[model samples]
Target: MRPADLAGVDVLILDRPPGGIAAFDLLETARAGGARLLCDVSDRDHDFEARIAALGLEAARDQANALHLAAVERRAVLALADAILLADPAPDAVLRALGKPLLPVTTPADLKAVLQGGERI
Candidate 1:
């Protein structure tokens, strides 16, 4: 989707940015506003697993610790994200199928430009 289309979204995601594109980097602004950032576990060589391990997360761990468990990068990002971005071929569809808030960002400019519009990315 294009910049104008994402008028009310509060979160942004992408696999990577366009070549030489320095303007868009959705995470920068989203994190600034405390928006969650979700990405597929496979996107970056299973970094999700490492994050979970580092955070001592256990899946289906418990409701009381849901917040704590989710604080693990993978789950936390999803839990806090107002919107999730998908750039991988099937990952986007998979995330959407799981009912995660998902959007598409094709370029860094798309993200950077959005912020330039005076709205959070």
Candidate 2:
């Protein structure tokens, strides 16, 4: 949605990687329009690159590479995000570096509950 279209939106939550390039722009736009932006960084595992390489499988290696790239993209989304939800425990150093708000999320219900809390949004 365009920035104008986000007017009065209560919350805008997006899954990175699935939303791809457009998600980054949308997060910024929605935030500008006074909507709360939340990013779910659940696609990439914490030790994806390292663990996949240790498995010694060609296909797994490729998947690891792809996950690494996706992690890079997630960083951009995190920059625009108002709050962050993690599928993995303690995000990597990059996320720690950004230092934006971080929230725990184990399931869809967990995320929904946080959104409903009405504090961070």
Candidate 3:
């Protein structure tokens, strides 16, 4: 979706790998438009790379490029995020490196609470 489409959005949840540059652009636009950014980093791109290698897939090269782009996009998104949702007991190094507020989310209710402006856990 275009940045204009996020005009009145109160919150934008980035839960998956970015499609490409456009996704990062959209996130920037949404942030500029005053939308709260909540990034859910439940999966790590490096893990996907490892999985592809383990599978002995010929598409590894292309997938690696995409994952690399995703890593870049994720860093940008994290930089703009108001809070981060982490499911893992030990937060990823990226998350810790960025120093953004980390919120542990175990269930859908936790996510809903955060979106609804509930107190940080």
Candidate 4:
């Protein structure tokens, strides 16, 4: 989607990073529009390779490789995130590199608090 489409957006929660160069432009627009960017990094833990293999797909290897590449592209979005939503307090190197606040939320109340500008639980 174009940056202009993000007008009036208060927050942009990305489960996965947007593909290609447009990701940065959209993010910049959102930020400029006073929107908070929150990356839900817990989704990164899903093992696409294992899942594809379990499904017995012959092209599992190729599919897994493609998925990995897509995940790698997420760095752009992560770098611009105002905060990260994780399943646990454990911080990975990538997340730490972003230097953004990590909010480990396990319950709906915790998520609500975080979204409302509350401290990490």
As for candidate 4, its clashing pairs are: none
Candidate 1 C-alpha lDDT tens digits along 5-110: 4445554553322211232333444556554454533353223344345545354243324433333434434444454454543553334544654445456774
Instruction: Please write out the lDDT profile of model 3 over residues 1-121, one tens digit for every residue.
Output: 7888999898888786365678778988887888888877777752445446654667766577676666676677677788888888588666788888888888999888887779452
How far off is model 2, as Cα RMSD?
3.7
lDDT of each: 0.43, 0.68, 0.74, 0.75
lDDT of 4: 0.75
Best candidate, lDDT: 4
Return the lDDT, model 4, position 54. 63
Lowest-sum lDDT 10-residue window in model 3? 46-55
In the predicted model 3, the residue pairs found to clash are none
Clashing pairs in 2: none
Steric clashes per prediction: 3, 0, 0, 0
What's model 2's overall lDDT?
A: 0.68
TM-score, prediction 2: 0.64
> In angstroms, how far off is 49's CA in candidate 1?
11
Q: Model 1: runs farther than 4 Å from truth? A: 1-73, 92-94, 113-121
